[model samples]
Target: MELKTLSEIDIISASTSKINQVDFENLTFGNVFTDHMLVCDFENGAWQKPVIKPYEPFMIDPSAKVFHYGQAIFEGMKAYKDTHDDVWLFRPDENFHRFNKSASRMAMPEVPEDVFMGGLHKLLEIEKNWVKKGKGNTLYIRPFMIATGHGVIAAPSSEYRFMIILSPARAYYSGEVKVIIAEHFSRAANGGIGAAKAAGNYSAQFYPTKLANEKGFQQIIWTDDATHTKLEEAGTMNVFFRINDTLFTAPTSERILDGVTRKSVIELAKRENINVEVRSVLVDELIAAAKDGSLKEIFGAGTAAVINPIVGFSYKDTYYELPKIENSMALEIKEKLTNIQYKLAEDTFGWTVKI
Candidate 1:
């Protein structure tokens, strides 16, 4: 295997090529790709030379281990362009840490932080035009790894492929998502890969989430696997509940995802004097609170949609609705967070990293 340092990557001068023309304004999430991509391979106990190539597909063996044994993991993050056209990434180091965590869970070799960050910079610099300048427009960065060894045996593969793809995307509009409080299905279990963004974890959710969608709901608020009593998280985001004025969210465990946005919100909420509870929230207690008119709001914190407020939810055939308030904690924290993301406000927490 050949190893190349970050300094060795050549800055290639290429024109802004267009392909499969689509309307940028009306684009749905993760539907459009930029002109360039970054790729690297791992073999013989080392990561090989990295390359930046045009956005296209390549050949892979039909009997690849990743196809048969499902050895894959991925992460979701975004890149923002400010009014001055400066590119920035929100808490990229956090994403780097989490990506390694996911790799460890999937039995994949951990990627070097220098390689990951350096490759990202080179890719972003090449496709800088894909990052539109506006509040809602940004580049969605998908970094993923797969077992590429051509075999079907049930064992860890000897070869792997690491690639980074960029999509010119508009803000995801998950307007007032209606959710079902989980009672029958579980997203993750104790000592499972639920804490990490493993590829299998997402595939396991499609069947259950599709059922919820058929029942006129947008997503499912997953509960604990052992007992199914405590709220864990949502399909793709960490959940937060508000009773009266206090904010309650489940603490991260071996079964819960340690979301960067979730942790940032907790810190910001505590600094703002919002009573935050990092404990297991039970369905019965929340239902009782809603009955007594104390449940004020509920939302999900994630990188895609900074904060997605839940308008209502159903549990065991009972429905609960949240009243909209003038001063919503969800909106306030989202504004403060996005401001730092777009470099429009002071990053007192030192969360923004420029590329």
Candidate 2:
């Protein structure tokens, strides 16, 4: 794979004439997609030519490594349009950095910085119309890497493919999620691939999450594998607990994904002079706080929902409900972050990237 200059790649402006005729007013997450996509392949130890073409399905070999071994990793982000029709990405560099991190964990080739940014920018240019212009409307971008080599050796593939797809998303509202605290099933263990956004990490949770869903729970709040005393993260998002106006969240470790939104929220909390504690939060401590009325609120942070407040949680047949406030720290920080994303507020942290 000989590297080529960004101008040399044949970027076809072609897009699908027919789209998902669904009403954008009411859309599900990741169900519909835009017309164009960005794709690149890795061979000979380097990235090949990148191209933007119409979104369409392509054939994969029956023995593709990603199919049998689940050698895939992905990142989620959004592009927002301000009131002036300007588009922006919130902390895109972080996502790029983490994408490589996931690639490394999955034994996939790392996508170069210039190649990733260049491909994303070029793709966005072709699909700009897909990005809606409103407070909660934006284009949800999914960048993924998969092992495409067709082999059944149960080892890393020599070839890989990196692609980006866009989906028009409405404001995601889980509506005060009710979570189930895990005491037996663990999402990821120490010295494992939990910190990475590997495809297997998500697929492994389907069964346990399905059980929780049957019990009238939306998601799972995973705990440490050894002890199950310390809280870790949720199925997709990082967890946070607000105790008496003080914000506390578990620090990123080998058992948690170093989420971009989680880090941004930590910064925004400090900027607002909100006391934040980035340490190991014990599940028992939170239960005690809830019993004593110190647990004000609980929320999850991620790029999908931005910030989803957990109204309550259950553990070992015990349920705990959180109090509702007119103005919550979760809501406040979410608005601040989104405002900066849409260029509606001052970008003191320089998180937004103009396209």
The predictions' CA RMSDs to the true structure, in order, are: 2.8, 2.6
Candidate 1 residues 1-355, lDDT tens each? 1222377554444465874376778888987888877778899999987788877889999988899988998888899999899998888888888999999988999988657888888888778878888888889999999999988789999899988999878766545698999899888878888898888888898998899889888889999988888988996889999998999999999889999999999999998899999999998898998899888899999888779898999999888988878889999988888888999998898888787
lDDT per residue as tens, model 2, 122-237: 77777777777888888999999989998899999998989999998975654658999999999998999999999999988999999998988989999999999999899689
lDDT of each: 0.86, 0.87
TM-score of each: 0.96, 0.96
Query: Which segments of model 2 are wrong by more than 4 Å?
Result: 1-5, 19-22
Ten residues in sequence with the least summed lDDT for candidate 1:
1-10
Candidate number achieving the greatest lDDT relative to the actual structure: 2
Question: What's the C-alpha lDDT at position 160 in model 1?
Answer: 93
Model 1 stretches astray by more than 4 angstroms = 1-5, 10-16
